[model samples]
Target: MNAQFFGGPYDGLSLATAEVNRYGRVVSKRFKGQRVHFVLLPPLADWERVRAGEVDSAPKHPYELVKTGDNVAFHDADVNERFNEILRAPEEA
Candidate 1:
């Protein structure tokens, strides 16, 4: 007998599916219990643009942006301690 387990680029990556609604909002519950959110950050090269107000900051939306719960992939890590730094709570700052 043989068996194969599902795999992805990274442990943080997963599969999910969602349905798009009006206003271009995709509603889904792939992260129902986890409450994961999606964040849209500007490109690193946009530093000057951002400082000049040309580039906008990440949108307020990220969580539950999708629901398909399929074909979605992500990766998480603590590279250079940067990830932990970002994970720090607001009050901790």
Candidate 2:
């Protein structure tokens, strides 16, 4: 399972996937010569539904690399808004 980042320092980068069944596991690794601290978010409440292809799509981000006092912190991603944003249409200029 690969992870994708959006609208942050790691935007457009694909990183290794963490254990989807487990949450709050801090993992340290390097990307592009820079050290990064991050963790995988908890699986959705209805992950079974997702796996069954019931939802429109799976989460684009299953983890987050939040910044905390000069170091990266593992935390839950804002999945609700992200889903809405995905369903929303872009406004015309």
Candidate 3:
């Protein structure tokens, strides 16, 4: 299957690609082909994956993408929390 880039609920955000590893790990997966981009997932997105057993990684791994952009790849503990602030509110609630 060809990977899809994520456009947030109202298209306020997007990702270059999503990669699911052979081990079942998932994130806003990146490839070298993408330039001047960012990979960020909703706070609930990773937790939902956890609930569904989609990711086989540690707790912080999901938000790893949010902590850094293309030029920097460092992990910051509060990345998820910070990202949640920018997500568009659901139209219904």
Candidate 4:
């Protein structure tokens, strides 16, 4: 589930993956930021509930649940900005 940022300045913040559970459910997603990298684990039973639509509350972030594609992407305008910033920054030489 490794993903590369295909566009924007902070393209280096790429190669992310979702952690899976024993049942092959995605339990978390990880991404690297300019100053920090983060792992966002699904809330307790969040995957089951999201799939079932049993919970009334909507997910705060957009996520993709697809099965028929070579690549799937999830992005928002803010994410695009962040990525661009990360890519354009000067690197240590």
The TM-scores of all predictions, comma-separated, are 0.26, 0.29, 0.22, 0.23
Off by over 4 Å in 2: 1-23, 46-61, 68-93
Write down the RMSD of candidate 2 (Cα, Å): 12.2
Q: Would you list the rank order by lDDT, best first?
A: 2, 4, 3, 1
- Tens digits of per-residue lDDT, candidate 4, 32-86, equal 4324222222343464664466654333322222233776433332354543443
Pairwise TM-score winner, candidates 2 and 3: 2
Q: Which residue pairs in model 3 clash with each other? A: none
Worst 10 residues of 2 by lDDT: 84-93
Better of 3 and 4 by TM-score: 4
Q: What lDDT score goes with residue 30 in model 3?
A: 25
Q: What is candidate 2's lDDT per residue for 1-93, written digit by digit as tens?
A: 445555433355444444333323444455445554545332445445654656533333434555546543333344445323422434322
Best by lDDT: 2
Against the true structure, candidate 4 has what lDDT? Answer: 0.36
What would the TM-score be for candidate 4 when compared with the true structure? 0.23
Clashes of 1: 15
Tell me the alpha-carbon RMSD of every candidate: 16.0, 12.2, 12.7, 13.7
Compute the lDDT of residue 18 as modeled in candidate 3. Answer: 30
Cα error, residue 76 of model 4, in Å, equals 7.8
Residue 8 local lDDT, model 3: 29
Worst 10 contiguous positions by lDDT, candidate 4: 19-28
Best by TM-score: 2
Report lDDT per candidate. 0.30, 0.43, 0.33, 0.36
